[model samples]
Target chain A: MSRSVTANLKTKYLVMTKKVIFIILALYTFSSWSYAGGGWPVPKGGFYFKLSEWWLISDRHYTDAGQIDPNITSGIFNTSIYTEYGLTNRLGLVVYFPFLSRAYVNNVVSGTTGDLLIAGDAINTIGDTDIGLKYSLTPQGSIKTAVTLTLGLPLGNSSGGSQQNLQTGDGEFNQMLSFDAGTSFSTKRVTFYTNVMMGVNNRTNDFSDEFRYGLEFGAGFLDRKIWIVGRLTGVESFKNGATAAQVNSTSIFANNSEYTSYGAELSYYLTSKIGFNVGYASAFRGELIFANPSYTVGVFLDFTK
Target chain B: MNIFSRAILWAIVWSFLSCIGDDIIDDRVDPVLRITNAIDTMEINTNYTFEALFLNHVGKEEVITLEWNTSDPDLMRIDPDGNATALAVGVVRIGVKGIAPSGEAVQDEVPCVIGNSTVNNLKERKAIVKTTSSYLLEGDAVLQEMEGGFLKLSLAENYKASTALPGLYVYLTNNPNTTAGAYEIGAVSVFSGAHDYELPSEVKLTDYDYLLYYCKPFNVKVGDGKFED
Candidate 1:
């Protein structure tokens, strides 16, 4: 009878183990379905196209002593369309086409107008196109980390007008290395996600090293179809090169200027694969940038295999 | 069969729990701090009103106390109610500090310029001149020439013209070595010979110290060898 009792205890333990495994599997399947319903970052084997108009108030400086004018405000209306095609479950290829880029400067000081200073109608031409590859380095259940390497080709109009500073492109070819890491979690009706990124720029001219950093938070409502997003990006550069004469003639006081912008975006998913987005952005304290707020509007198309 | 199966089940459960804990820790920090209508910069010797709105984690409105301060004591002064008064002519750093309900602090600073004074002495004058073919035939001049004929003048204490001319002319000297400089002056004959010349309605003396003169020769009639004044 003791032997029979031991056998029954073993059988009970086995049944409990099976129940635990079954429960885990059920939970995993349910979470996966819920993630699909929520519109977040693209999953593996997915493709997406985003067309956005990014407006920038460039507070770029030309000298280290800060002798040139620091309040140079210019508006750049950029229309960028990029597509990401997943090559595998962990790797993807991205191609960006900045088909239209128009920049304008107003309220310039005297002796820096017309041909002397960069002024006139907007110049809409192709800008530096970016080609890159993104690979997911760490893919836990709720957290993901990715690394990307991008090459900026000077295939756009860089020498169109007499104003050397008003070129449609930055002229030199560059390479940007970045790391993007993010995670998401959700319950029955709420969802949350956060991401951090860092970019290292390599260029020919000694145009100071640039540091770009941002944080993004998003939440969903209405059956996880509509979402609200907020972002804050800050850029700082160290002055390393001699002041260029071209930029100095236009404004007073020149030094490597730091820019910090905070803004919010609202997006609505029409279907699981298409959505619309709008946002307003402004620089807090920029010398050579616009004093007013800049606005943006765009659309996105997402797909998964 | 019992011990091995139970250990495997517990290990899987622990792994999942660890993963969830890591995610929570990573997303705990707030992503944004929203402050609206915050004043960044203002001119000195001028009064400005400042206000701001703070947003909480859930995008809800929250009450925040704003503290005002300036880098330069003699240059400017700011009060807690967002009142800024300029004291001197220079660049002053104005800072706005926001204290949230959770004791979080955020600050932003902007540069403000204090001018010496506003231009009040410069004046804009208009002169009219009319002429006809009969007057020309009779050798009568169209307009009488004044000592400073049709000259736009701004006379401030300790500021004087080096050389005085009767016709349209500009000063070669520049003033206000501190920061202020002459911007521009424009003149045009709107009504030709038969109409009067109207200058700009107002001009500030502090802004300008040069004179731009538009003078035409006086046309006096000499009939039958006698000059008519």
Candidate 2:
């Protein structure tokens, strides 16, 4: 009888633990959904939130002569949840949290000896989160342009492994000044929109200043319920000052790493406020970079209060 | 509306306009043009060539021209065509002037060493190896007989290859008797052979020249009568 009681107690304890674990998982999922599901800076005055996954494909591995190797490909995966609060019709504030996974393989050179391998754990913590203030400079009926000043804080795992050419965090504080210009035209059945963004990044020793520019084009379909989008992004970085030993070390290919990516995304809205998005991106070509393609899947909820 | 309320509304409108003006001003600032490909210390004889591509500003390829100058023009000289020639064995400062489309110019400089070539007796050679007649390979280590001829080697394996811009000469020779002197062959035609050529029993294999392999930007020259292996 005592053994039976003990067994019953054990069963109860297991049930309680399972319940707790289930609750914890549900809460975590809910929180992530809330974080990523909303916010895009809209025209004039509405709070917006967006959760997005960006996959960087084709880091662009090249031969010593700077010729691109088609076989060598790699990239990073980033999941970001951001929210924007409209202070006024013309001004807004935004906060974003990002998680990253960086992986790569090098197959450019002959022989298996020169193979470059880079893999790291997922950085789910807040990485170089950006807090920014955006204000509309020009607001026409159909066209609008905005300027943003953002402060990027190194709050994520900056130093996980030396192999992280796919670094989750740049390990330094940075400031980015950006400009975004967008325009939209709609007909009875379709809506067409395009946005161009340019950013200037200021970084520290382990990092360098960079210029990032991108163009996003999209069209809404099926009574504005489905959207197909294409984007082209390019980045150019200045070289950091290397120490004498670093210059002598042949492991690091630190000269002129430039990359460009092109991608297409399909998004479907289930309701007026909820949607799912998936995308595929590839680095068309690059120098001193990895080579590969990246993919993204995300769900979003958008609303205004 | 009362006069006071009307005045407050106008003030709000004016404030909004001022904010818009400020934002435009921020966006109009000249974009910082940073040269990411500047070299700090370059060896003169190292033969390095890099490209400068314009970014941010589109459709303005002609607007930017790169002008390079050396600190010691006697030691090194850079042509307007982006060619760097070593004048003497010495250290020199190399400066690149970037002329923007707007007539604005930016300059960057670096130090470089030009090494002197100690061996000057290197001769450029070209070789063409052709079968005297159609040859075939039935299987591995099998023999397919054809017309007998000697192969002329174009490059020696021991010569250092140029890493930068490289030039290659390939030709075919028909004269089998002239093996000691440089012989030029007429129009060479390339086609798929019915069978691969087999080594002749009378001819020694050690006299054959091996092909030289080189990575890009580096020029490779093969030495006389030397095999790459």
Candidate 3:
């Protein structure tokens, strides 16, 4: 009789935990608009859309030895739209398009004479775009797995400004194949989920290929009205591209750049279908990349609810 | 207003927020007075007209009146205009001093001996280049006066630089801090080993004091080599 009671209590505890996990999953189905389609595909005919602005202004950069060195103050801003639409229950289409992008450099002025040494320059154009298709491999498992194939299109100005130093894109076409696996669990009151992703990006036009990886963890709070997400994304170059000396260009957007960045996002849902998000990310270790933080602000709409 | 309209407004505001700004750099250096045409030996009973160049606090050449001085009046006599005459068979230090616009006094001195015939100073200057940043830049640079009054900058075979830097260019400048008044040589096509850069005939051997390695597009200094003995 005592053994039976213990078994019944264990079953009851599992049922309660499962209920919490379900509620968390339901909340996150609409919350992953910023980094869309982590491990789950949207329901059939459902859609998610976001309008965002991302920017980075840096006066320093990381050298090939992973050391920081000062550079001219430069800024790049992109106004983009990200969307995911479910073609079927297990297949989804993803698109990330920056309709407007701008890059600028600061004017260099002489400290002694107060004369302009180099005039500042700016360029405005469409940024690079990404189109992808994601398919869920696990439909009813406790841990979900998905695979995505993405194609990167070079659409922005690769070289601009008077000195041809300003750029909005890397001017290369590439493709990436990624795999994501995620799981969810719940405590007494808070619900949490974690996802891991790995990918291989094959690049063209003398640009080096890259190996990408990421880990993301998120929690739902305030009765699932607000969610906080933390992520670490990294890229490692293959170092097979032509060197700057070989290319013979003055552009700072050379090949073989790598960085490992950590970011946090705060998302608040005003309604079930409408929400807002703000995020900040910075690299703690990098090479041939900017040694600065980037910012993002966006509003998203989820039709899955 | 509605959410979509508010989102559109935000995008427009972000687009307009990006504007060109200014970056001020500290490019000041100590003023210097250099004897451009100094001789190692002076002939007895011969007069030589010396020339001096005064560089201001910012390393810009400025016209200033120089006062010439001889360490021993018995060995050599110098006038206010830098015209010097050897008096006896001895050695003396020829010195020149000038006051810059910023009220800073600068001076230079060179020793000379009264010998059989006057000989010009060494025609070749050498310097060891070292990195000022995190980049890998180290080399031995030689500046020599070539025929036809041209200058030749030669990098030794031990020279090596980081090929990761873009738009790496070499320049000759009086100031080591910036390229404001520097004469750009050209882009550096050689990353390692020996290379030679031929300067125009108008570029004098004493025109600059430092060999600066800079990134033209990034507008940052990588390394510098002082013109030593």
lDDT of 1 by residue, A1-305 (tens): 00011111112123232110000000000000000011112345666666655555433322222222222344455566656666775566667666666654433322211122213333557766767666667643345566667676765554443433344465556576666656555556755555666666565443445555656566666654666766665556554532322222211111234456566666666776566667665555443233355565556665642
Docking class of 2: incorrect
Fraction of the reference Cα-Cα interface contacts (below 8 Å) that each candidate reproduces: 0.00, 0.00, 0.80
- Residue B96, candidate 2: alpha-carbon lDDT: 68
Report DockQ per prediction, comma-separated.
Answer: 0.01, 0.01, 0.62
Q: What is the lDDT of residue A270 in candidate 1?
A: 70
What does candidate 1 score in Cα RMSD to the true structure? 28.1
TM-score of chain A of 1: 0.70
Predicted candidate 3 versus true structure: per-residue lDDT over A126-236, tens digit per residue? 887778787878756778778888787888777889888888777888898888777777666666777787888898987788887877677767655577777787788
Ranking by lDDT: 3, 2, 1
Task: Give the top-scoring candidate (lDDT).
Answer: 3
Q: Is candidate 1 or candidate 3 better by lDDT?
A: 3
Q: What is the lDDT of residue A71 in candidate 1?
A: 27
The segments of candidate 2 whose C-alpha lies over 4 angstroms from its true place after superposition are A1-40, A43-46, A56-66, A70-76, A100-126, A162-166, A238-256, B1-229
The candidate 3 chain B region of ten consecutive residues with least summed lDDT is B8-17
